[model samples]
Target chain A: MATTSLTTETGGFEVRRLWTDERSRAIIFQLLVVLGLALFIAFIVSNTIANLQRAGLASGFGFLTEPAFFDINQRLIQYTSESTFGRALIVGLLNTILVSSLGIVAATLLGFSAGVMRLSQNWILSRLVTAYVEMTRNVPVLLQIIFWWSILTELPKVRDSLSLGGAFILNNRGVRMPSPVLEPGFGWVFGAFIVGAIATFLVAKWAKRRQDETGQTFPMLWVGLVLIIGLPVVVHFILGQPLAWDMPERMRFNYRGGFNITPELIALWFALSTYTGAFISENVRAGIMAVSKGQSEAAFALGLRPNQTMRMIIIPQAMRVIIPPLTSQFLNLTKNSSLAIAIGYQDLVSIGGTILNQSGQALEVVAIWMGVYLSLSLLMSGYMNWYNKRIALVER
Target chain B: MTDQAFHRQQAELLPQQPAPATTVGIVGWARTNLFSSWSNSVVTLIAIYILWLVISSFVQWAFIDADVSGTDRFACTSDGACWAWIDQRIQQFLYGFYPAGETWRINIAFVLLFPALAPWMFENVPGARYLRWFSIAYPVIATILLAGGLGLTVVTTDKFGGFMLNLTVGLAGIVLSLPFGIILALGRQSRLPVIRILSIVFIESVRGVPLITLLFVSNIILPIFLPPDVALDSVVRVIVMVTAFASAYMAEVIRGGLQAIPNGQYEAAQAMGLSYWKSMRLIILPQALKISIPGVVNTFIGLFKDTTLVIIIGLFDILGIANAMVSNPDWLGLSSETYVVVALFFFIVCFSMSRYSVHLERKLDTTKR
Candidate 1:
């Protein structure tokens, strides 16, 4: 009763209860926020409409039918200047996917090897790899792209091209190699390859069950490889060698009649893989270190050699930590491939820019890019998150 | 009798013997580290060879046969790097097209950066309590000094290019995004469902897309959304977009910090009858912000490096200037030399900042080791 302080309290009407009430304040704040967002959206839409009309810029995706009229230097599918803008955009998208997929494969291999080297017992090897990782990671990848492109373009001209046993040619233009040309009866070999793949899968399932039941191991890896490869080769011989090589031959101006990998593609691929590989190496190292030394020591105590300990104990545990960051690194590499535009690699953003300029439909082109990248990101993270959860340690 | 004999010790302990010749000092170290086994020996030798090959060729091309100074193609006839262009156009690379006479203004602004940043970065810096006020006012001071409006000649933003442009965008984005990041982070943590959901959607959508796409939006689509009468500066547009892009990632980083704080602190503040804003400001935020310094610095480094993307949008950043200089008629081709210089600049800046973040992490860490 003595703690009561009526005199110190504010007069009854000095402040309104509505502002003082926490629940009421929260409701009011949220309502105001909703109203503000609605008004802002309304404003932007109205302004955009008025501006688009006044500027006389065409809207909608109808312009997709219009001829691109711009020639792309490299393409996976058939493309000509007369193709529609939509087709051109698809071509660019395919090229981006091609580069990104190849870069991912290369980066993972490089990253894993570099990661192992960084942790190696040899001091010089570890230090050398560490220095490389730091240098590659800290520089802007775009600079590397430009650097690699310059080096590639500075290769000897067609007149003095570097030859690889008359099967491959390298010059300022690009790398030219024998492209596979399939003749009649190739379908039989292809079918045999498919059949071998199915057989291998069934045999693997059977082998796993057999091992569980009998405690005896089958050489599954060797058996699968033979089935997949040997079957196809044997079929090819029986069918009189249906696959032929179209070797590149030098022409007066340029090399023709071979599979050509452009300097642009190689430059982009090299730069992206090396740069992203640096980051991936760091993640790999962190993942490895996160596994306690006790795990490896225990493996050794159980009579495992160094390589066996690393393989049978360390690597399996480290993968749990490695995978999530690796996926994000892959995503970053994919997004960074957009920088291919700077070097005229004709990636999605590059072609989209051209389409935006030609059609003056800035909104649509930007939307398409945002939609594609955002969806791709969501799909990958979703899939990875599920896999990560499945593999995640079930802690008590 | 056996025990009595065993008890006798030598008057002089056996003179301390040196280790075996093959197992002592540097030789011993090398044996364990570089030649522990047949495989290790092979690996070390192969690594040394590869390292020698890379280092030798780089040094030869970059230094031994490189040209140092001249005005045109005549300056660089060597097969090595033509550093003549970099020497002559160093100013353009550093300051862009900002006028030569006004270079001192940019210099002062950058010089002032040390003082401005010191107090914010280091609490015990000399006279930090006073210097913090200066830090707070630094943006205005830098702006006035760089643009020159108050009793000084004006310099427009359009004249800005080169590395200066990179700093302009990077610094402005760093400064402006902090508050938005904090607000968004708090909103994501808020009890109000509407606010929480809105923040989540904004953060994820921004995080999902790449910076280049957003830059495209800013470059091509943003102007259309604004009223016809109002024109935004291109640099301002870029800064706004960059700030927005960075703010999302910053929100996530700050959120991690916020989540690290124990719930006990929040309840204690509430138990003391402190209001929501007061509790956050006086208690929750200080601790959260302390934990977030390393992440913030890392994000800044990433954003700084990402400023190179502006080159693709036609801004004449340092890389852009280098590209232009290499293409200049006087300097027909020195792409390698120019790119190397630019890459070195980014490497030094980014590498140092990353080192600083590591330092800050060590300093701020209070968890029991």
Candidate 2:
């Protein structure tokens, strides 16, 4: 027994020694890696400093306040060639947001329709949708942008503008339409809208809970729609018509006295929406197909109508598959909005480029560009994550 | 009573008839598929009418009414598409300002690349392993042939910026990015803390921003970053930016493939006493790459299309050249035709690449039970 104990102790010591050697080797390897990284960082840092000093250029954000001497073709806010660089950047950012938001709404609607049509029982409709998706999605988006811009440019000049009745006008300058301007008491109407929205949300939640308990459905959608739309209309009437319209009138050479959307914005928005819609359509189709036929059949077995089955059984499940890819497309559209630069729409990059050239502060301009884009990306991803969690499979 | 019942059953059982051929043939298919319901039939009729209208108009405009042979803008006054503008400026679009006589050099380079690239893509081709190195080497040869660096009339990078230039930049970026992407992907999955951190930072920083920003940095700020006398061409700047952007996205794709690999594969490699790099190069990458072929091809397609964005930086890529060509005094109002032709070109190339990707996905599918 003593001899066996002695042998066990020796074996333990041997195992411990082996472990120590292995641990030391790992430590050394890790240390070497860290050392290498530190050295590389230091090298880059020094090189940057040396290069900056050699170029006799200052690297700081002080240039943001300097006067931007360049003129923007289109501006969302009041901006001029004499505007501060910061203001110019803001104008660019606002334009980017405006185009992207419009594109997203339009693309989503179009995409959902095409995606549904692609799966139709009718062969012709499905084939047509497939052809559209294939043709549009496969081509380069930049090329599409140029294509649309060129098409817009091919329109007749302001003198020989294409007039659609009297309400709308299209020319090389832009498309002009009657636009609404808010009058007095519009604030009250806006307040009513907010109240209606909140009430609709609460009603929807209550309806859902009541359905869960009683196994009875509610006309939540109709109720919500009436509450939301009717309240605003009622408020508007009570406020004695809270908005006025300015209809465009034809002048000697051009349309006057109404809101005009520049051709650059229109081309960018059209190209982005159509191009992204094609991809989104494919994603939507895939999402729908992912829902098994058995699920729909089961809903039918429960005496649900076709539309009812689609709304309740199919869409809920499809959302799970659709949301992730949809978010990516949204991000892509946002990024692609920068293509407005090509057509001189003065998006963030274009404005930034202008500033960079004007101020010779390339590093500062680039850093700002990176920061804004990165923040936008992060915000989008964060929202998507929250949305995904809401609709995720609730495994007990 | 039993006899009556038996007779009733016998009478109920009539002879079975064959299905009508018309109901199962092309006529039936058209009726059911194209004109099943009233609404469907109406839609079909409308579609046919519209299609006929469009086709006839297009054909008449494109061929019947178009002016085919004139030098000035007034020669294209026909109601149809002016193929003459395209014919007039075809060389400008393809070769940009490259010397007309030396166009053969680009042609020869393209011919050489095809044979070199074909073998690399074909698994059944002989010397498959050697083809990998050849793919790497062929680009160098093509670059020299095009750039004319040694004992030849050197074409400046600025002059070389055109459709072929875009293709070369995209292709070169893809080639350079792949190896870098693989390394970064492996490092991200590595046990080492430093490598993991570095890989994550590199990938995320690049991916979180637009490629335009990166291009801006490369174009304007890269010169500042370099030494005082070091002047890199705009083409080089664009190429570097493209490669950097591609690698970041490729790293994410490869990491996805890496995550998909079963841990047992790694364990089995270790059990076989293969070193880390050997295990990765031999066992892991082959499987991961196979699993990620569809994604890689998609990235390739995206990069190929995105090369057009170089136009924003004043490079005369295909789309850029087309845009410029349309603005020529002789073809001022022909922007629509030029754009249509360019869009068609892009559609063909990108569509084929996507179709090839789908085919590869099917061929490489190994998930069947």
Candidate 3:
């Protein structure tokens, strides 16, 4: 009775309880955290300002408009040393996008093939694929880049460059390939091609519906291919053969008048694709494995052919597993394009480095780099998320 | 009645015939795996052709026609690889311009690394527990050996290059990021909104940018944060940035491990009347860390490869040293040999790590059973 009275007699909650109470403790800790963070940020800002003042450098975006005195070897748009830094950065950004897109396409094709081959019944083929994936991924990509660059550069000089019947020329400078020159009437051919694509889409939808309703499949693949390619060719001939090839011609010193892809681009693209391809193949293999054998067996039991089972049952499930990680791979490829600096490919990071060196505005350049990459990452993730949702299984 | 009679007669056993000759031994295995269908047979033939072509060409270039001996570029007569370039500069590849006499320090560090790493990696080995202390002390000892403090002749950070620099940066990044990663992982999952937000911001931002940009930041911007008189070594700066970048990735990997832990485990720990930190320390972290081993190793491999990026910002890692060697006037065009050597070195390390992780995964897969 005395102990109970002593506990009840205290007007306020016990000081120990207040300190130990999880809720109150959490609140107090958070407050202290907020205060500490504020102090830290303030310190950093003040320090930066003081350093900037001492260095006699004003910080802003005004430097972007200043003339860039350096010339770029490869530009997607018209630009010279007279161009502004902003234009140079834009050119760099485009080059980065170009390489990343091409790399993604090549890597996906190679990776998917290798991934499927890895699971092939042929022992030697599977082993070879495994070797490729393991060896390619383990080595540093920069080494691969330098190696490719050196191989291309070591090619015999322009005079003795390898030629493929005057259609293509290979030299240390670049591979000169025949460029397609489209005439005025090619627009009609292109329009016909677009029409063919739309027709194929409609036909495919009809075929799918027919397959569902009557259990009858159409030759959609063959028909679609014919419509797209045949229709375009027919339109081209009817319009008097509007497309012509401007073949590369060997000259006194080098090839001229064609699409000359520089060795730097080739090396950069090859290294990026092969390196990223190994990783993508692993993802693809894992995705395929994640779907149990029972799924294919079930489809087979339903009387579907092997190809049909793969197309309708297995691929859909595997794609769900593949896409999220695949998005990260694409982002990685985009980021790795910056290694172009090592080979002088002039991607965004490489150009930014040049700008930073010339202007001495490290802060602004870094901020720009972080901002551009963050936006790209976010955009890719957003699109992938939407795609993932579309393919997500609907529950009962 | 007829069906029953037939079944009884069939059950009266007959001797099973041997499998057909085409369906036995290696022949049978080949038939099923490589020629089960027309398409399969076609693919098999094509694969064999491609494989033969590649192997023959590689062998011809690498062995039959290659010049492995005779000192200089002029000695290379065959139109193949010039491995003599690598043979000549093997020392530079292993230890980029540290005073030749100090080479013993690098050798000691290299020899010590495996012994230090072994106990931690294979904890179940006999007497491993006794050597656990050595693992903790290894990094400090290695730094002192490399940098030369405490009465030893000091080697400046710039002199630290080649494969040694790669190991230094990779090991430091991977080891130092772990504890910070755990904190960030926990913070991201915290009940407090501010802490969670901060963690998310840090992880996302770091992951968003490329390692190159981050390296640039360390090289260029870090010095400005300190007073003019205080100069930070470039190697230290780069290591700090790498650690920060790696921790962000590590946090996400750990978060995956954390999420995999069922709610019941957390509830059971809480129901025992243990406080948050105590319960987390004793109950949560061990399980989460155990589950995170594969992912952590993958991150380690990535960080190891990324250590080569330091070359872009002017540090001489293995790739940088190799790149420099390629530009040597004597070895003007032996880029293939130099890069191949670099690739082989990285491949051996990374491939072994990947295989070990796979083995760990297999060993750890006990829950299904």
Candidate 4:
């Protein structure tokens, strides 16, 4: 092809040609975008500074070192009202992670069970599950959280607390459970437990290799269980039973000497789990259905039991579909756990809000919340991506 | 041997007979569906017992043992739920602190919503093409009607609460986010690196954080971001924040729809010498948007549910109003009744929306035909 001249009419410059030049246009457009963004950021920064000055607030990390001076009932770490704002926030973060992790575990179990039940052969069970999922999912999660919180709070006061086998105590204030008191000698048991865990991993690896090479299956479940559990038990006995229960005692005004679980945490955990569980069940159901019926039929033809077919054939294929959405659901459950604030769960956001009010560090507090949550989400999605890569079907 | 020979010597097949009682109708359905096996029977029985307990108790609390007619919580003498408080506060629940007389404007706006949205929501509404102008202008019309601009008293947003607040905020987010969502989605799909990166950052950052964080920004930090002299209405600030938050999710959905479009469509548009804007407006977006309608509806459901978060910052959406009642001195112990009513309202609205989405998906299923 003959090269086109830069200008058709050499005598006169045509400015319209500049518009058609894709390269310069792209560069110019990007420059404009960058300039606009810079201008926007400049405007906001100027405005924020002026507003902060006018409000008589000096914006900095200085406020973080100041005392929080607020009571948090459900602190996961050691925190007092006299603690610095930073420490309280750390306590709040730990509490948030605790409730979120608990919610995730409970939600997954509930979701998987409900999802499977919804696909069961029995009609009543499926319909009941459908009703549950619809009802739980459709109502606002905030309402559900508040609903559960209210119910828990409406229970009898601590003086009139309900006792469960002298080990657990329930009241409007909270639930108290007998926590294990570990003596120094229990460290050996812990060490042995870790060793047994390593042994379990090795045994599983060996069993898989043995099965692959020799076509002889090893009963790894039994052997692994014996190693992990029996080792700990034997170590505990050898160490002269160094574990003792710190049983809760009903005192005058409140329970003493036990692990206290606040009503807020229980309510938040239950609500988050049940609400997210509904969505997850839907995901699970869709995933299972996405695996063609012929898959399970083929598994059955190969003389596999129903459970074996589900485990070995259906779930592995279905997981390729389930895992992606399940990741988002887990993230959503974590994010939704922030609703703890509504029900007085002193989570990261709630404590941040308190700190924001106390110190007038609105910008810093909000930024911290956004930064923490964003990083958390990024981390979760990163892990999920790696898991997805592992499970993704390799195709030509 | 004789009996077998006689049976085999039949000259004609017997006329078809009806299935046995045990293999047809309700009995058969019961056998197969409810009691196919011993384990299934046990489960069915357990479910039935649980359902009975739940339903009977609910009915007892809501109706049979309940007192419905009263002026306040005091009028209830029943052992079950005191629905009388709800009856007394029903107006407040529906309209919040919106003045009783001015509710006519809200009523009018709500009525017009059907006609305005009908053209867009359904393909074959009567005179839809002519009504398109009204549909496009609905946000302006609604704002003027609700906020008062033309020959009406201006009601500040603080008065905008309750179920009306939910609808307004939810509707505002839905309306404002769509165009922005489309733009962001297109930007993400752009060939230009600057636009794509910015769009990705904006989308992911918004989506990564829970909406409550954004709400806090609106409540505490948004004002600081504005010029010193400029004071934004808290409700407007919330609407803006929520719209931005939802736009990211909407962008993701629309991007999915865009990805589903064949590359040939873009190539064909380019080959036809269509400018980018012209092609996107006339060719690409319409098809992409059409495909994204179901997902868009699902996003709307989520957004609607999320409007309850406004209550955390002290705005009185339905749940907020319910919460207020729960904490009120007179209705202090009626939290369950109030919450249940609120939950039921949300359930009805959201469940119907999901069903409609499902129906729409089925209707738009091209593979079936």
Candidate 5:
């Protein structure tokens, strides 16, 4: 009984000592940091309040509903000078999304091609790709943007525009393509598109499951394309051809009668895509290199054809290495989209700047920018996390 | 057995014959590198043809046809690049709206800075250990030269928004940000909770937003927080914002370096009875910095590139000046030429830095493998 009591008492003492140990010092340090942060925040808050009061300016987000008097040059959504600031902001957001999506697609395509070429046995092709990557990436992207913009702007005026096979026109105004106008039965065609999309997804799932069960591959891409494209066309014809083309025609002064993409948007998109593509190309090359040569040789030994091996064995593994840095490039592209304002593409920040100057609501506009950007970042991080989890290597 | 040995000798001799003369020298290099196969040869010929076509035209336009000096566009009708516009606006491109007579001040400042900076970069320089303080002092001297407050005519920050201004802002941001970044990185890694939490918040918040948004906040909102009577210069405001942004990125890079340091070094220092600060200052930082030299250089390169973003805030860095130069009616169609020059300038600077970083990386590579 005496020994047991002594042991219990020792255990108690050890627990107490652990609670008061150097590791606990970290907790104390943490507490002090929290306190310091709190104090600093309080100081900033009070100082801000004092300054705001002195400036005679009220702070809040009430300005969002106010009419935005400024006109945006290029907007995807419907917007006007008399639209609410909130609506204008939506336009900016849409523009940002549109440009970013296009840039991501273009950059991915170009980067992947260039990256693969850089590792090619063909010395000329590889060196050319290397040269392109090095030259484009070393220079500031903004300079490239300006360069492309200048090139676009330097093109002959509308009257003397370069016509490509009489279907498209290249001029200072921008590239003009024939746009399709939806007619009365366009709703039916749109419904068909949705049905085609669902069918394609279902087919893809079935194909994947079939492959898993039978080890027989189906041409899923070809099937999906046929359904998505052919079904839409068939439905459109059944609905009495519910679209009309608005072809561009060169007039006395300028080209008219087509959906016009402003030169500013074209310039910004071209620059962002080309510049980001260069970096992404390097990342792709690195990822491909990171996949050891033994893997390729092993695949070859397994009797797989070169293309099949690359598609099935190499690319999947390479993608796992590529995705993380690729995500960063995506983020960079998104951020670089703000350069639209330089060429006057009227993105979110530019619109906010306009609003701030007009309403003198600097504090509110800044808060909105911060909140929007932070949320966007959080969303991106969340997506990245999901992607990472999906592609993560599972080890036993 | 003799006949078999002779046959083997003959096979070896056949393999040892000299290659054809056509398969050596520049021609051989071209055949191998540019055109090893039929398809490859076709590609090479086409590439050469296209290159020749482009080069001849460019040469004729840029050198033969282009005007080198004139006030108006009328002098430049050559099929080549119009270099006259560059000649006329080169000063504005470099020093943008700075007092014409006082342009010598910038040159003088640059001359002084190079010698001071060279010693820090070169291993042969004497007193290399004390040169750390020069990094601090150089910016101060540069600011005085640019801003002109010390018994010199005051050039306002609003007027300081151009190409040279961009370089100054970017360089200043790098210098100021690095020390702050080192401290913050240390703070984040520290056992102290308060410092870590503060560092986390600062880094996350700054890293979360775009630089343009930060510039907006600095330009518009920062003034409202300060006392109404106190007015900070716009350039100063921009510098502070840039420094804050750059430091956050630098902190992450430095922390990566710090984390990579072996734990035994710390234990060894502690066993020697050196205090925490001493151990960190003398042993930890030097090693960590060496490991992170590439990362730091990359950050500097990124900072330099990002300096172009100041154009959104109405500042004219090299890119901004180029843009402005292009917009002039007299040089309206000369944007491509101007941009090429600007790109060349940036490429030279950035490429050199990257090469230097690679050199440093090789030098500092201490891994056993």
Candidate 6:
């Protein structure tokens, strides 16, 4: 083809040939794109520098060391108003991860339940699930957050707080629950718990091997559960009962001496979980539906029980369809946690907003947010990709 | 004797009768769908009880026991919602502080949008082809009417709020994103390495971050990036940011559509002596976009929802205005009523869009036919 093209085009230098040739045209178009992009970037950079200088703001990481001097109520790390901006940002990041992780767990559980319920044999239940999903999903998530926040904050104040027999306390301040206080000898129990987990893995592996070799099935699940829980209990007792509870008591003004979860965290967590769960339910439904009915029939033909069919056949196949979209839902939850700012939940965005206001380093603050969020996105996608590869179907 | 006895008695075959009442109609439906088993009956009863509880309370709070005419928080009772707040501020909710007399301009814009969009939305309607011109001209006309640039009282970006603002931002993001998204998708698929990399980077980086940060860029950093004299309207900045964010997602959706097209189409176009641009324009995109209608609509729904993020940066769209109303001293503690109203509005829009997408999917299901 190359020889024919060269020989045919050798008669004379034809201007029309230049226009007709695809390769030359492609190169020219690409060059134009590159040039245009470069020029645009240059223009923006020049403008940015001029504006920064004119506004009398130095653009760099110098502002990060300055004191944040802003209060954050729902931080995971130790953070004070006197903390540096960098420390405050870290606190914010930790809070983001905490909310996101907790939301992901709750959303997954709720979503899977709802998704399965939507496909249930009962007509009323399925329709109710449908209504729940549609109603929750259609409205804006930010509105849901604000709505929930308002509802929580409207609860009666600390003095008139509602309680569940001195165990769980609820008020406008937040929910106070009895905190588990681990005593000195609890380390032995924790160690035994880890050992039990390893033993469970070994037992499952051995059961599968035995089943493959001799056609004998062992109840690994029951054994594993017993081993894990029993071992922990045995160790705890042997260590002289190393667990105690710090029950929240109603003090003069408020509950004291227990875990005090702020209203902001509760509201944010509930809103994010419920909102993201709606979308995740759709994904779960689609994934389960993607698995053909034949697979379950085949499992039954092989003498598998209903529970066995789901665990060994249907769920494995359904997961292949579920994981990809489920990853995006997880990432979306992480991103949506930024809405915490609307309800005064001092998340990464809220803290960054404060820092931007205080330091006048809008450029750097924005960059930090983008960079952190992008890295988080990349990391999540990478981990999900690895998981996908592990569970991927192997074809010969 | 045996042979005579063997004269076979004719068998009496009775006509078939209808099934029992318990096995037909509503009774049968209930037996099978609701009370097939003990567990099912329990679930059905539980569902009914829950539904009754929810509906009764909702009706009581939203209608029967509600305050519909009172003007302030003091007039509201804790026993029920005060819908009167919404009724009183309905004008502000629909047309945020756009001088009361000039609200007709917004109304005109709102009324004109359907006729413009109808040609494209319902292509089978008669005379749609001729009305395509209206769709083309509507954006400019609506902008002129709303912004009041051509010999009308000018309304600045700050004055744009409420549902009008939501419509403006959402519509602009969706309409502007499509063409740009298509370009980016095509660029990602292009043979040129430079263009492919550029498209990938733009798409990924934009999609990576939450939209609130992008709104921050518009609010705080966008001006710094532009030349000193060219101060962009904040509304325009938001529109631009939303378009950029949405186009990235749109590009991925369109790319999925593009990938579903077999390579034979490309080869066939090449064999016809069609240039790359010509083939993409005439042969490729039309078919790809036809397959992508549902996905595009989904992206539009998501973009519409994301427009609420603009409120985080102090731009008062519907959600923002609702927030403002909640915080207002006169309307304080009426958050539930305001939220319900706002939620209903959004639900209606998003739900209809979802249903329309489903309908379109069925309509375009050529494989079934």
Candidate whose lDDT is highest = 4
Q: Where in model 4 is the C-alpha error above 4 Å? A: A1-12, A213-223, A234-240, B1-8
Positional deviation of B256 in candidate 2, in angstroms? 1.4
lDDT (Cα, 0-100) at A53 in candidate 3: 96
In model 3, the runs with Cα more than 4 Å from the true position are: A1-18, B1-21
Evaluate residue A72 in candidate 2 and report its C-alpha lDDT on the 0 to 100 scale.
83
Docking class of 2: medium
Instruction: Mark the regions of model 5 whose C-alpha exceeds 4 Å error after superposition.
Output: A1-43, A183-243, A250-256, B1-16, B19-32, B36-57, B119-122, B125-136, B144-162, B262-275, B366-369
Of candidates 2 and 1, the better by TM-score = 1
Q: Name the regions of candidate 6 deviating beyond 4 angstroms.
A: A1-18, B1-11, B149-151
**Which residue runs does candidate 2 get wrong by more than 4 Å?**
A1-55, A185-220, A234-240, B1-16, B38-56, B123-136, B149-152
Clashes of each: 0, 1, 0, 0, 5, 0
> Residue B196, candidate 1: how far off, in angstroms?
1.7
Error of 4 at A12 (Å): 4.7
Per-prediction CA RMSD (Å) = 3.4, 4.4, 3.4, 2.3, 5.1, 2.2
In the order shown, the candidates' DockQ scores are: 0.78, 0.60, 0.70, 0.85, 0.50, 0.85
**Residue-wise lDDT of candidate 6 within B211-252, one digit each (tens)?**
999888888887899887888888899999999999999999
Per-residue lDDT of candidate 5, residues B43-112 (tens digit): 6677667667977987887688777878856787766777887778888877888899888888888777
After best superposition, candidate 5 residue B113: deviation in angstroms? 3.1
TM-score of decoy 5: 0.87
TM-score (all chains, Cα) for each model: 0.94, 0.90, 0.95, 0.95, 0.87, 0.96
Q: What lDDT does each candidate get?
A: 0.89, 0.83, 0.89, 0.90, 0.81, 0.89
Residue A258 of model 2, lDDT score: 82
Residue pairs with clashing backbones, model 6? none
